[model samples]
Target: MSSTELQDRNVAWFTERPDDSQLSADARHLLESYSRIPADDVVEHVIKVRNQAWTIFPYPCIGQFRFLDMSMKYTKEYPELLERLAKGQRLLDMACCFGQEIRQLVADGAPPENIFGCDLREEYVELGYQLFRDHDRLKSRFLTADIFDESSPLVKLQGTFDVVYTGSFFHLFDYANQVKVSTAVAKLLRPEKGSMILGRQIGAVNAATHDHKTNPTGKMYRHNPGSFQEMWKKIGEDLGVSFSVDATLHELARDHFRFHTDDTRRIHFVIRRE
Candidate 1:
């Protein structure tokens, strides 16, 4: 579809999205408890901010409200993860579109000052403050810079985070660019034993590059668990650092996607700096 047509379709999708009451139990609790928003107003607020975000970038994740789905809660490592964050280690949320994960971290008792979020668009970062209603209360910094741009302001954040969280990212790029992005992420992480890169993404059963309408080059790499591990192995070699990749791939259920398809799976991963 044409760019304008794609935008129109995305707008409709966001406008007609489901109510927040339909969100998963954990997600609903997080919104109600942390955001201090009444259950009656949750859906309206989510829809309003999400519609604004959709206009900025019409991503399927934004339209489908995937940000509300907490991948961290699903992981077995959540307790340890929260402990690390609560201990005052730095955490960065890469490509943090609306800072939903950052807010969730705060709600889980992680120090707000230790959390940071970065995104390419300033609008998304600004909207995050409004969405969580924590402009004054939350101290975490939200920066705006392109992750792929080596000379961008993100360079100042190099080697600063104890953990970096990336969700629904990486698959957006072709293999070569994926390596570049991974390298950048590695640079942002602490080069210590326990530091890690964690999150989830869409993956293919048979890992390979796939055509995406949003990509001008028309290709993006999708990984199965093995391919993802291999990619990180190569990244580790290239960076002169060792990493242990722990990942799992599971069938895509109806709740994970707006449309059901057998070709995709959810890949949850943790890459530790060793």
Candidate 2:
């Protein structure tokens, strides 16, 4: 899709270049600490990498450097995830643009071999290597697949992961598509107590489908905590399993941006199979 068309979905696409002040401190830390970009050149490095990824896909997250946020750090489950990864338990990062969180896991002492990252586009994965400057060091495997496709590589890896992390994902789909993705995620995780799916997404006080600017005919779901739980519960029932959903919707200091509105809230969720 044209940049002009993508802009409507989120105002950041093709907008005027934002100043360095717009980059978050956490993102800066990752660039300096994990990527080893000199503190002085971090902004320049981020800009160079972001520019390359945008040419591949004008995702709002890419334009805003939201991918660098390492969302799992803020969740209550963060410490637990770190513990799980350190012990050789498997984890998968879905829609892990630039593989930022995977790098964070490595930086935090998790074994790279225990973690996996996947996205729909492989270009983002290539750019991720550039962004982190870790092509030679990081051993985490990155896969590219469509979550909704039954024949997709991600879908084929059912029951292999213990923790599935999706950063700024799920909100990109309509209700039906969201259900499909959730079902796929359910299967992707080990079907035992404590196997979990967790992530951050664009949420709303009111749950509903909204217009998708990148795809004119497409719809994206903005869910509240209740709606999100209901979705997984319905899926669990159909799959003959049970789930424990812990979700909360709240605003963040970062929400005051071109990509969000008053209705926007951060949905932090963890769904564990029981």
Candidate 3:
């Protein structure tokens, strides 16, 4: 294909064309039972929104409907997490795409106003509304801004949240940016005991930087449990706080993507402010 063709299609990142197989049962339940989408039309509506989001960024997660993969319920802390949210503690779904998890939480009794979603693209933020078909009723707030931008609107939200659910985030950058991302997350967290961060991301048995599929020199960091904890330990000391990091890796890349990476695993983690 010509460079123009590839550029226009973003074939490098948009290789996978997903169908119903990529959609999860929980997602279907949320759409049908919660969002009130007709059962017959749920798949079509999801495909349409996924394609619309594809135009913004051809992320593997979006194409595979990984955004719909709810990581909250699987966590060991889920019961308490939902309980606290229902009791008025707020949460930020950092890098939330289509706010699927947010909808699930709301469906499971967490207050919609207690949930906040932030994404770098306003289009994705708006797409969440379209995907859930709840613009008129869902009370969750979605912010469209980059966390790295010093003057971004997210700055106004620093230190206000009790929990952050950030699935498939943080491994997207190199070490420096990973620290920056963690720092940004930490800044958003309430600096008190019980402030917590939970979610999953790609990890490697050996911490390293992997080549980006789309860019010649772009790299993303993958961490082992030890390295991840060490980074957070330093961050805690630097910021005069303490933390406990629980991370583990077992699931392989092939389980989620067509392309497989050796030693890559899904790291499930919970970091708590202590």
Query: Which numbered prediction scores highest in lDDT against the true structure?
Result: 3
Instruction: List ranges where model 2 is wrong by over 4 Å.
Output: 1-22, 215-217, 253-261
Quote model 3's TM-score: 0.92
Ranking by lDDT: 3, 2, 1
lDDT of each: 0.80, 0.81, 0.82
Lowest summed-lDDT stretch of 10 residues in model 2?
Answer: 7-16
Candidate 3: clashing residue pairs, number: 0
CA-only RMSD, every prediction: 2.3, 2.4, 2.6
| Residue-level lDDT tens digits of model 3 in 209-231 | 88765322267788999999999
Over the full model, what C-alpha lDDT does candidate 3 score relative to the true structure? 0.82
After TM-score superposition, what is the CA distance of residue 255 in candidate 3 from its true location, in Å? Answer: 5.1
TM-score of 1: 0.91
Residue 107 of model 1 has an lDDT of 87
What's the true lDDT of residue 168 in model 1? 79
